[model samples]
Target: MTLQPKNMLNRLLKSLLVSFVCIIVLSIIINLTAIKLPILTEASYERYLILFLYLIVMIFYVSLLFDQLYLSQKAKGISLFFYLFIMTGSLQLLESLVAQINVQPKAIVDVIVYTLVITSFTVLIFRYYGKGAESYTKRIKNYFSHQHISKWLLKCIYAIFLLFIAHYLINSMLTPFIEPYYNGRYTNILKMSHHAGDVKYVSMLTHALVMVVGFQPLFALWKGSKTSLLFWFGFPLFIILAFQPFIFNVHWPLGFRFPLFIEETLIMYIHAIILVHLFYVPDETHKEEELVKSKLSLSNW
Candidate 1:
């Protein structure tokens, strides 16, 4: 389906409006239930607003970019809910683990309940809309041929490894200059040294992986067609999403100064750009094959 600019704008505005209302309602629910979720209690109103905006952007990214994968609106809605739940749940789980944040048993139960509800919704959606529908697996396999997929996977792996190395090297080099500032701000308060260790490495890897994988839909849509509206929307959106956390101070596993933050975020953008280029760069042979397939499909229609 062709997404006109006006339609895209309307969809985005609707998503933003709905997301705002949902955030308010969710805040009320959390307050009423007295569940102790991480970051919800201490965060300011502005932070919550940023979080809601990010959630809406993610929904847009999935719904518009991967529209072909789902059979109907119901499937798309269920998938969006699943993605939101999994994304927030994974973040909570990771924060609890790495940041040593305290999460109450009631909160854990709440998370499980929400998960089950969404999972059930997903099953029903699939049962109804997915019957005799083209599976996402098949769609992906067709869009990205086996050879392209293999090559892209290797490139992603190499890019990630290089990212890790650059992260280590950059951090090491900047430690002397930035350590004093970081130490002054957080060292005594957190009672942790500024030196690198397992936690730092683990956090870096986690951040890099999340950044790369989170933008996979954007990559896929761009690869399918550079002229796609989804590609145009997603390209800048991806960059903004990468920088949002820092902009809002939403959550950071470790503390650092502006310089370090900019460096790290730039590295992430580079990683994403490399992955997109490696996966989407058009070759004459692949273009010819795609053109032929397009003609055949059109003729069949």
Candidate 2:
């Protein structure tokens, strides 16, 4: 509820400004050190322009989340810090692992520097001057309480598998459209088409877990309905995940971007919808009623 179209300027501008300032610091670091990320393409003015726009959009996405979760809801700074760090860091590390990109310690350090810069700025500025997490506390206490330990594990496993299926299904269905765009442009591309033991699943597993962590605070703290969560939370997330990579690698035709966007965003929104549903644990009033519904089920048998 705190993040409305009219009032989003408060959150969006601050985050972008902070990220931009931090990016300058990061650019300086790259200039000074051997630290580099794995972008195989040479830079051009047009490519740099695209990169610039992508970074803006990416920063806006992150800031939107920061506003909804921490600034508007008053979640803890530690939560924000860890969310930003782990989400971005895990993405870098996992991509390096799965894509088999030859990432070095310097690349990791690059991620760390940017993560810290953005996290510290948001925590200091927003936590200090913002409305605070009164809503976060009230919403969480009102929403969920006791849950079965077994149910927690089941929820995680159930969500991860289903999320992976959604991701795989989308990519597989769209590959016909996307493969044409591959164009033999970049041999250094990801060959993660669905296979028996593709490493992409590993990335999906990590994504599912990270998504769960990210979802919890929002579900508990956000004052919006599931639809708002989908738009505010899910849409922005998928946008960044879908488009951020296109920022660096300029070899592939822009043709793939749309289909790939469809694939990534489609799966991600499904992910958010699933999380929203999965997290809808029974309150105390229905806890007993909701449990053990089937007489011929495994438990009864």
RMSD of each: 8.0, 6.6
CA lDDT, every model vs. true structure: 0.51, 0.60
In terms of lDDT, model 2 sits at 0.60
Alpha carbon deviation, residue 105, candidate 1 (Å): 12
TM-score list, all predictions: 0.59, 0.71
lDDT tens digits by residue: candidate 1, 58-127 = 5455445445344445545555454444444543343333322334546656665444443443333223
- Cα lDDT tens digits, model 2, 167-188, are 6677678868756534444445
Q: Report the Cα lDDT for residue 180, model 2.
A: 58
